[model samples]
Target: MVALILILVGCNSGKKGEAAAEQKNPKCKVETSLFGMTPEGDSVMLYTLKNEQDITVTITNYGGIITGIYIPDKNGKTTNITLGFDNLEQYLAGHPNFGALIGRYGNRIANARFSLDGETYTLAANNGNNSLHGGVKGFDDVTWVPEVISCDERAALRLSYLSVDGEEGYPGNLSVTVTYELLMDQLFITYEAECDKATVLNLTNHAYFNLAGEGSIRDHILYI
Candidate 1:
């Protein structure tokens, strides 16, 4: 009847352009390998980014989480600045500080007592008696060790975790490496650590930005 309705509307526009190019290049990704479970038995490890003006960034490895950050504004359109907590029991019942990844001694060791070099340490007051970050099981609640070094290109997936010598009380044998690079437009996070027996380190990354998206972004347009 009209050439089969124009061949069924051009085969439904070529299947909607192959479903929008497989949702802009996502071909199944699910491997957090259980980073200490939470957010419903765990599942968060998806890293995909496109630049050169396409802008997209999705990083996850549990506590290596950046979750998602798509950027491109100034009339090009595409923005997702990063803010979080939608699972893991609301990030273990709230307040590990958004974007997580603040560690060892990110800010406080005061009353947790510290007298390194001569000995005299006692931690885990868990922020009140002192000792935040690395105490109460820091490293954003641990659980890392995901490597994807490369397949030749579009690489960079190395999220490490190795903390010994008194878990959070900090002593030594620490090793941390958090690198999630998606070059071209920039989404480079880098942190390297080393310790053998002289504890106390503070790392940070708690991305809570808002360009006016997600719930309660606080009236956008802030320039802080």
Candidate 2:
């Protein structure tokens, strides 16, 4: 039987934007702590979500990154099933998207430029001639304000970020919110956003999972 399941919600906004097997009744829990401090002396926090099934997901405000995800196997053994660093320094140093929240534009814009209503805007071209994942800094590199919400059914961490106009060459001031919820044997993510002006916007979570607990997924079966 398969061991772990990682669900990622990638949200893309163009200006406007489940249950598991039965077991012992366990209450969902959420814990927050200081993850680290940025070079600019900003404090970053880590929020951990634990479900009734003992599955745990750790996320940090720095870049809105999912630092870790722990899931149990059929044998009742738990292990972290995602790739990431142990500290904020490593994340700041750089790595693949790991488990970052990509935004403004998730993919790319050709030539790092776009036109709207006969007006042209130029963006940062970190990915060759195209603008990749928002831009050089993107949403992945910014700090988000976090709010923890809990109820009888689940616990959630709601993170919010405001992208100002002219930032990364985007036209409008965008307000974004992403919530991560822990329920029975599952993780739910929700993303919402609004912009003051008409501007291009897209958002997504880049999380890589390893179901077997280690190694390449070459031997695993995928069903799209």
Candidate 3:
């Protein structure tokens, strides 16, 4: 899996609309509001972080998903550069795990089972006969505890979750924290985890980027 580090260089540009008008502070700041509630009656909050560079990113406690990323181009036109839904219902309904945080195991485990310490473990076979992304209800389908970290010129949101032993057939109790930090021209995602027992873990963020804001990617070219 790739390290979830996003660098938005030269993003210091003027923006219009409510996003710009809401910038009462000239420095970095994070604000929160009710995004929605899960079927389990858990409240999910939306966090909006605006850096000094005028880049704005919206994240939800539900799955720690990135809902929007607004950055201005050289022409001073700003658009959301990420693909995601506008509300919580769409997410609960599911749509390719857009902007979600994957965990436990990122890719797939063939036959939905693995052997460790001479013992065999069976996981959820959600993807064909394999275990895909921690099973049917992975970290992406749960609520996370959010904490805001403010510095002189940067904003960060720390999302923490605890996975108990035998969750989705995974052994050991795991504690995970994923932090999204917004700097002048960069967004850093840091993942940290600790387990009481020996268990496999792989974490990553699934975020689709479109520099042109939205639409087809056939004409889009990647540098790396």
Rank ordering of all candidates by TM-score, starting from the highest: 3, 2, 1
Q: Mark the regions of model 2 whose C-alpha exceeds 4 Å error after superposition.
A: 1-26
Ordered by lDDT, highest first, the candidates read 3, 2, 1
Query: Candidate 3: misplaced stretches above 4 Å?
Result: 1-26
RMSD of 2: 6.5
Return whichever of 1 and 3 wins on TM-score.
Answer: 3
**Can you write out model 1's per-residue Cα lDDT over 118-143, one digit (the tens) per residue?**
99888888768888766777787655
Better of 1 and 2 by TM-score: 2
By TM-score, the best candidate is 3
Q: Which stretches of candidate 1 lie over 4 Å from their true place?
A: 1-53, 57-68, 71-76, 83-100, 105-121, 124-126, 135-153, 157-169, 179-205, 209-224
TM-score of each: 0.33, 0.87, 0.89
Residue 197 in model 3: lDDT? 92
Candidate 1 residue 25 C-alpha distance from true site, Å: 12
Query: For candidate 2, lDDT tens digit of each residue in 1-224?
Result: 22233354442211110112122334566667778999998988888877777788899988889988888888989988888989999999998888999988999899999999899999999999999999999989999887766455666677889999999999999999887777776777787899999898778888888887788889988775
Score each candidate by Cα lDDT.
Answer: 0.59, 0.79, 0.82
Candidate achieving the largest lDDT: 3
Colliding pairs, model 1: 39-88
- Kindly give the stretch of ten consecutive residues in candidate 2 with the minimal lDDT sum: 12-21
Residue 42 error, candidate 3, Å: 0.6
